[model samples]
Target: MQLQTIVPIKPLGNPINYKAKIVNIGSCFAVNMAQRLQYYQFQNTINPLGILFHPEAISRLLEFVVNDKVFTQEDVFQHNEIWSCFDAHSDLNQLEQEDIIEQLNSKICRFKANVFDATHIILTFGTAWVYRNKQSNQIVANCHKVPQNQFEKELLAVETCLENLKKIEQNLRQINPNIQIIYTISPVRHIKDGFVENQRSKAHLIAALHEYLEKNKPLNYYFPSYELLMDELRDYRFFGKDLIHPNDLAVDYIWQKFVETCIHSNEIPTMKMVDEVQKGLVHRSFNPYSDAHQQFLDKLAQKIDVLLEQYPFMNFR
Candidate 1:
C-alpha cells in the first residue's frame, strides 16, 4: 500500500541546459528557486524589481519594462523619511526620492534585458488579493507599512487575472518569440487574509492560470507547487514558525522535485560538480597553515578551473 500521493510532473519539451538563460520573477518563492539556480551557477536573474506577489503588479511591471516606461517623481511618495514607489517592492525604497528613481530605472534596464534575452522565465504568483492605493487607483506591489485606510484591499477578479496573463503573454512573445514561461502558484499561505478568503484567492488564481494555459497552449506551462504542498507534504511540520510559509525543508523538497522535472538530464553531472565546488568553497579549515587544508584549496581551485574551462560564462563569484 502507498503511504503518500505522488505528483507526476512532465518534463518540458525544451529543457534548461547550461546554455539556457533564465529569469525568475514574482513572489518570494521565485527568489527561493532562483537562489538554487544561482548556486549551480546557471545564467539567470531573479526578481529584478524585487519580490512582487500579485499578477497585476508583475503584469504592470513587465509592461513597463518592455515599453521602456521610466519612473519619475510623480510615481513615488515620501513616507516617514523613506521614498517608495508603488510600482516596486520596499527593497527599492531609499532615503532620497531621486535615489529611488535612479534605482528603479536601473533595475528596469536589467529587467528589460532579461525579459528579451531569457530562454526560460519562471513566475510565481503568491496571491490574487491586491491592494490598490485609493488616491491613484493603481495596484501597489507593497504597502510599505502605510495605514490600511490609505488603500483599498480587494480580491482580484478572475477575469482581471486572465487579462493580466494575456498582457504578459502578448508583451513577452512580441519581443522574445521563443521564450518559455513556467507559472507556479506559490505554496505560501496567506492566512492573514482569513482561512476562507485565502482559499478563495487561490481558487481564482488556479482557474485563471489554467484558463490561460488552455487558450495559449504554445508558450505557457504550470508546475503544481501549491498542490505539492497541499497534497504531498500535508503536515504542519512542513511549515515554518509563522505557519504561512513553507519551511526550508519543504522548499528544498519542492526544489529537488523541480530539478528532476524541469532541469535537463544531461546537466545533472555538471550540477553535481557544481555542488562539490560550492561545498568546498564553504568548508572551514581547522588550521590555517595545515597541509591538508592547502591540498583541499588546491583541489577546489582545480574543480573551479575545470568548470570555467567548460562553461566560460560561468563565474563562482
Candidate 2:
C-alpha cells in the first residue's frame, strides 16, 4: 500500500542539460538545489550577492544589476566595527568601507554577466515578512544585526509582492528574452515569525506568485517544492535538529524529484559518471603508497580525463 502522497510534477519542455547555464537565487533553500547541480558538474551560480529571503530584496538586486549601479560608501554603513550593506547579506560584510564597496560591485558585475548568459533562472521565495529601515524608510535585505529599534518589521501584502515579482520578471526578460524562469516556495519554516504568522507569510507569497505565474505563463513555471515537503514528507523526521529546515535526506528527495521533472534525461548517464568521479576523488586508502591504491588513483584520473575530453568545462581539479 502507498504510504505517502506524491506531489505530481510536470516535466519542462526545455529541460536542463549539462550545457545549460543555471542561475539560482533567493532563500537558503536555493543553495541546496545549487549544491546538487554543482556536484553533478553543471554550470551553475547561486546568490552571488547573498541569500535574499523576500521578493523586494531580490527585485532590488536585479534592478541594481540591470541598471549597472555602483556601490559607494553611502550604500553601506558601519555597526559594531563591521561594514555592511543594507542591500546584501552579512556574508558580504567587510571590516573596511572600501572592501565592502568593492565586494558588492564585484558581485554585481559577475551576476550581471551570468544573467545575460543564463539559460534558466531558478528563484526560491522564503517569506513575505520584511524589515524596513526606519531612517531610510527603505526595505533592507538584511538588518546586519543592527539595533532592533532601527527597523520597522512588516509583512508584505500580496499585491506588493506581486509587483516585485513582475519587476523581477521584467528585469530578467530585458537581459535575456529566451531565459526560462522557474519559481518555487522554500520549505524552511520561519518559526521566529510565529507559527500562525509563518503560515500567513507563506499564504501571501503563494497568492502573489500564483497570480504572477497566471499572468505570465510562457517561459515561466512553478515547482512544487513547498508542497513536496509539507504534503509528501509530512513528518518531523525530515526536519533538521532545529526542526525548521529540511535535513539532508529531505533535500535529496526533493532533488531527485527535481531531476525527474526538470533535468534532461540524456544527462543522467553523465551525471552518474560525475558522481562516481566525485566519490572516488574523496576516497582515502589506508596505505597511500600501496600498488592497489596507486592503481585506483590512476583509474580515477583516466575517468576524469575521459569526461574532460567531451566537456572541457568539467573540471575535476
Best by TM-score: 2
The backbone clash count of each candidate, in order, is 0, 0
Q: What is the per-residue lDDT of model 1 for residues 1-317, given as tens digits with 9 covering 90 to 100? A: 99889888877777789999998988988888898999999998988778999999889888888788888999899999999988888998999989999998899888888878899999899999999899888889999999899999999999999999999888888779899999999999999999999999999999999999998878677888899999998899999999889999999999998888889999999999999999988888889699999998999999999999999988787
lDDT of 2 at 20: 96
The positional error of residue 281 in candidate 2, measured at the CA in angstroms, is: 0.7
Q: Which stretches in model 1 have alpha-carbon errors above 4 Å?
A: none
Task: Kindly state the number of residue pairs that clash in model 2.
Answer: 0
TM-score of each: 0.98, 0.99
Evaluated against the true structure, the overall lDDT of model 2 is 0.95
Cα lDDT over the full model 1: 0.90
